[model samples]
Target: MWLLLALVLLLVILALEMLRFVRNMRTIPGPLPLPLLGNAHLFLGLTPAEACLRMGELAEKHGDTFGLFLGPSYSVMLFNPRDVERVLSSTQLLTKSEEYSFLGRWLNEGLLVSNGRKWHRRRKIITPAFHFRILEQYVEIFDRQSLRLVEELKLRRSRGHAGVNLGEAIHLCTLDAICETAMGVSLNAQTNVDSEYVQAVKTISMVLHKRMFNILYRFDLTYMLTPLARAEKKALNVLHQFTEKIIVQRREELIRSGKEQEASTKEDVDDVGAKRKMAFLDILLQSTIDERPLNNLDIREEVDTFMFEGHDTTSSALMFFFYNIATHPEAQQKCFEEVMSVVGQDKSTPVTYELLNKLHYVDLCVKETLRMYPSVPLLGRKVLEDCEINGKLIPAGTNIGISPLYLGRREELFSEPNSFKPERFDVVTTAEKLNPYAYIPFSAGPRNCIGQKFAMLEIKAIVANVLRHYAVDFVGDTSKPPVLIAELILRTKDPLMFKLRERVY
Candidate 1:
């Protein structure tokens, strides 16, 4: 009887091993993974992006696409440009990965992360909000606050210091831009970091970013399993309470305005400003598809999703932008020339759309930076049905990973893929070009970033304004760039520091 019981246990273990890789699955090909843990052991000393790069190198040698099982998190990573193009463009058989389980807790069914009908509806509803006419109206609002940073650094560089840490400053500028355009709130964080709302926004965002990777958060039975989870809960609670308070205040303000309107017109109707606090809330608050109205919690989810994705991606691009420009004085000088050429040696005047448009080289510089260090490091999807890629069978639940970071840097793709070269974007015709997928900083296909135009506009304005005022230089170690750490996006592990020098020109 004891022998029979042992036999049954052994059979169970064997069954689990068999399920690791479906042999009938076309097997794009990948390094063999250990049981239960799969390829997780490969990530022992690497960030997720670094690990993906390492895996990508292995895949290039072995095959264009390959499968990896990190625990039950199985996904085929597309290493070749061809494979990535197919997976990203063909959304029918592939859907967003289940790995985003953590991010989903806050997003609900927001446009950026939701699926199918809900995603379609939200996308349709929010499309009008970002219409060029509406977004163009906010560019001046972006420029107004960007000057605050240039002014702050002006004071810091008077003593012959190298540079001020610009990460937080840039974040402030973007925060103000997003706030004013979306929520109709006014904040100039470039000049003041101590603002209650700014601090709360930053703290809560930091806490959320820090929570996604805590393995202990995965366990339900263990309270003492991870202190990180507890801290995250506290942060989330505070953020929700804070957001609700703001929502309530906006509601009351709207109510009073509504009452005044009713008294004046002698008729009843919802307050235009009161019905929605800002564009961020307005997108969801005013949404309806065939009479399916979004609830307040639904509104909360969408607002938070926009708030997070809005500042984070732009901040990543800007940080890398400054770091790149600071290191390459030639590039920075060229950018200044480009800006001055457009603005005509003007220092006192603020940048406008026409002026921003004139800096074509600067636009190329931004594109090149994004190609090398894309804001979103890794994009993932899951196989909804058994699918074939590059003549290989990819099974369902397989997480397909692709990185613009690697594709953009491949020697086979770009001339000097690793080198900083803005001229790569100077091609006059779209036909005479590299695979568009090879340089997707804002991703590609139907689900690419909706706010990309808004982000680029803000970035160009800020860069032009900063150069018009001051020239950036590295104070300490220009020899070593910030080590890349992959979270929701690629971030510098340390605060990217450099010295700022006032341009005597």
Candidate 2:
């Protein structure tokens, strides 16, 4: 009789938990979720790329805002710009979603994932690194690397451009550029494609993306039992070790040069009107928060964060830029003409920071491409306090997803939203008429991307250099678009193919 009573009590407890879960979900409209598993089964047997597309489809059917469950966690996805603005613009809602905690093993408390006072302090310390004068100095690096990329492509052109994986080649170029600017170390990732550091970065991202969609891997013990988890551990060791080595080396170099003291005092700049030789890592080494200096582990987190953000995001945007230019011949020719006008007929002439500003058409094209294919398809924020969206109550602890991918393509926000018309970004007429929150490729608000200016300069520099010499054409089936996957950053499911032809001036 006592045993029977215990079983009844256990069943009653579970029944109450179920009732509470159902009550919490009843306020929000979404696809019906199954017991225990929730909506996780939607991703079964689907690749990340396919899953991304399916998510977008669900958003389309469910309207602007809807709730879903990833395991037991109740979350809402916001597709409307107004809803997104409300969540992103709030100072109190600064905490990132639980999904980002998955990256803590790699990124720790870096700016990308940190919250509250820590994030505020780090943001202040790192802001100076991307200053105009410093980015002006980076232009020389961008121009030189772009020239190297041109040379590499010329070599690959010998094999014909029919099946050339331009995306992979561009990724290498961006990786090399970021390593130099961010770490002050040359990995030469473009030329040395077999570098362990480069390979490890690639592997870690793949492992993390797979883990994200697989609900079973959410628990540490369950994940550890999987082969992918072992692979992730190996890749992480390689990545963490690489960053730690660079941080130590950079600190030692700064002390030897006696610039460590100067870097700590003020913005590091030379008397000759040129920026100092300091990189992002150097700034982090010299930075402190509330009288506390960052330890080696803290430094490593920021360095790894910058390296991942700087390279992967820019490369994804560039790949889409190349695709857009290839498909639209008229826009490509206009862009080429504009680049030639500013850069002149000499293909060997280096693109300067000033010259980059004058390529108006090229800038428009880059903006248009970004709008069409944002590198980060969605931004996840965990609600810190109870919030109301369009008269609906969203309780605290709910994960809210803001999708630039869906918002950018909304017909209400953009006229002819699916069309790749660069003219829409024209500064004078149409651009001023649009809403700021509606077109957030780099996002908006105080937490908007600090590296946006640097990204723009890099994109313009590389695209201009390529268009100065080569005219790109789509070699694949033009009817079919490349399958897009949203990991931490957006990516193509397959290689982005383009035919490059040398232009005779």
Candidate 3:
């Protein structure tokens, strides 16, 4: 009798969920979904690049706002800037989507995925780590790493290599810079390109990407039985062990130098001594919540977050920036001229923060690149409470998908959206006015990227350094552009090749 009663209760709950799903289907416009599977079949067996194109087709068919169901989970793709504003700008709707849970084993409660009070507390603690004073110091690391990359590229040009892959080169350059700045140690990723830590990061990221899109791998019970699970475990072990080891080493160095105690006593990072620079890990080590210092696990999560976020995103931005300027010779020349005028022709003179600030034309080119190929092609958020977004009532538990890729290409938002025009972002050009939410490469509002300044500074430094040394030209056919793979970061399926000619000013 008890078993029968329990079965009846379960049926009733399932019935109610179906009713809610029906209500959503009636309210929103999208491709008709089959029962049980919904739109999951549309995405199944598709590569990330193919899947990205498929999403574009769906948006074109369903208008700005549409609903899709992957299994039992319902997601509303917000293509309209107003709807995106309604979701991203809301403080109450800050919870990440279920899709982000794929990163749980690796990132844990890191700032990127953490929500509610935990996110709030962590954000507050980590914000100061990117303050202008600290960022000013990071410029040294950026200049050094970028110079190393420039030398490597120059070496390749000398060896009769007509083309260099900017994608691979920038990834290593950014990795080296992030390691030194975030952990106060050099993995020398640019030098030791085959390091165990670098390989583990790549391995784990690939496994996570595979799991995120595969409906069959969503659940832990089923996923654990798969071969990818073994790869995930091994990669995660290497990642966690490396992060923990670095955290221990950094903390010990801080203690021995007496900077850890000094940082703890200080109310602000600016108050910390100017003689010694603090890594992001050092700041987390000194930080406390509810009067208790954060342990090794706490420090590791934030550091690993920095390591992942800092390098990958910046590398994507740089790759696109290189491709954009390489294709647009006029824009590339303008950037080269600006860099020469601002930083001078001396390639040996490192790009300083002050010099980087003065390259206004280069800044415009960087902005355009971000608009065209945002590092994070898509952003996801989950609705915790039933909320009215852009005058429509979206039910709670619905996933929100905001694609910067689609938004950037909307003809209504940007004039000549398909063309690469750096002047589109120039303040004096009024061809099209931009909504703050419309062109969010670094995102917008309260939960916007805290390290945006750091990213911009690094990008400009690298671009200026490269342009100052070499004239870059695209190596691919204009008619056949590289296919974009919308993974953790936006990347092309093929390497973005560039030919560099040494410029003698």
Best by lDDT: 3
Give the residue spans of candidate 1 off by over 4 A.
1-18, 22-26, 45-53, 155-162, 187-225, 251-278, 429-432, 476-482
Cα RMSD, each candidate:
5.3, 3.7, 3.2
- Measured by C-alpha RMSD in angstroms, how accurate is candidate 1? 5.3
lDDT of each: 0.69, 0.82, 0.85
lDDT of 3 by residue, 1-505 (tens): 8657755664465455555666887778888766556677899889889999999999899889888877547788999998888878888988999889888888899998999899999998888888777888899899999999988887767764758887788899999999899888888887787999889888887887777777788756558889999998999999899889988887787789776665774375567625567788878888888867899998888888888889999999999998988888888888888888898877788888898889888888889999989999989999888888877778999888899988998999998897898888888864667888999998887789989999999999999888888889899887666799988789998888888888887
lDDT of 1 by residue, 1-505 (tens): 8657755665465446447564633445677776655566776666644754576577676665667655435667675777777877775843577656556655666676788877777777776666555555566776787887777666656743545777767887788777667666665666667876676666555545554443323323332246755655665665566556655565556456664223221012123333432355544444556765555676667676777788878888988898889889999999998888887676767787667777888998899899888988888887877778877777766777788877887888888786788887888733337888787788778788888878888899889888887788765587765667666677876777767766665
Worst 10 residues of 2 by lDDT: 265-274
Q: Rank the candidates by TM-score, best first.
A: 3, 2, 1
Model 2 scores a C-alpha lDDT of 0.82
Provide the TM-score for each candidate, comma-separated.
0.85, 0.93, 0.94
Q: What is the Cα-based TM-score of model 1? A: 0.85
Q: Can you write out model 2's per-residue Cα lDDT over 1-505, one digit (the tens) per residue?
A: 8657755664464454445446666677777766655676777788888888888888888888888877546789988877888877888788989888888888989999999998998898888778777788888888989888988888888875365677888899999899888888888988889999889988988777766667767755457778988888888899898889988888888789886666564434333115466577877787777756688998999888888788989999999999998988999989988988898998888898899999898888898888889998888888878888778788877888888887888888888888898889997756546777888889888789989999999999999988887889878878877778877788888778877888897
